[model samples]
Target: MTLSFSPSRPAYLGVVRVSAWYDLVVTAGFATPWSYALLHGGLSSVGDALGLGVLPALDPIQTLYANLMGSVVVVWALLRLVRPLAVHGLFDGAARSLFAMWQAYALAHGAMKLLWVFLAVEVGFGLAQLLPWWPSRSNEVEPALQGR
Candidate 1:
């Protein structure tokens, strides 16, 4: 058995780059607590821009929760940029996939309709992270043959 990690293809890497940038701007909205003015507007003049249907009104608790979640997302985004090809990067993408699935499920069940956008974006980013690493028997065996 053998292994190789010569970095992913450029197309996949480009997808990750775009995804990271999107994460930056979107997570900023979550952490800032003042980006809920665009589009249809949020619960307040400035609330969750995504307008979480669950938290239709931004109270103290909602504010605290949003900030906390956003902070974590910021850290994850930084990690994605810093180590895009690292093993943990796969985990990061997988986590986003899960988040997307949850949001899609909620939207389908008539919960948070606003999550529709998230479902699409998350799935796209997740596929970018995951699909590139798919392994082939040739990839596993070719390196060993070349080395020998």
Candidate 2:
């Protein structure tokens, strides 16, 4: 019997990349509708109900722009993950940068809960890249040493 070990760094990265892409796609699809609804429906009613002194009207163009910006940021973050650079240096740096930007955006928008969720996802992805998974060794019989 023999034991062999294999590392799965590439596969881990591939899964991360796929997850990132899926996020981007879903967000992109949701962005337009959400922004439109926020601008047209919620903002005014919420502002009036809260007596926020005539909140600024939502601009569809601005909403679209913000959505595009978010998509771009997310894509950049994904790229950082997929880049074939040193795990510790380039990948980590890029991930941190992107996550910081996301946090800032969320804070600016008063979306703390969303920000936390995004932060968690970002941290999880970074940790996945940082952690190494060593393959399990197979059980094998070994001979005992004899002493005179």
Q: Report residue 67 deviation for candidate 1 (angstroms).
A: 1.3
Q: For each candidate, how many residue pairs have backbone atoms clashing (under 3 Å)?
A: 0, 0
For residue 27, what is the lDDT in candidate 2? 50
For candidate 1, report its TM-score: 0.66
Query: Per-prediction RMSD in angstroms?
Result: 6.2, 12.0
Cα lDDT tens digits for candidate 1, 1-148: 3333322333444555677778877876667556522322543333344455543545667666677877788777776677564344456578887888778777777665556667788987787666544565345333322332
Candidate with maximal TM-score: 1
Clashing pairs in 2: none
Q: Candidate 1: deviation at residue 83, Å?
A: 4.1
Off by more than 4 A, model 1: 1-7, 32-55, 86-88, 135-148
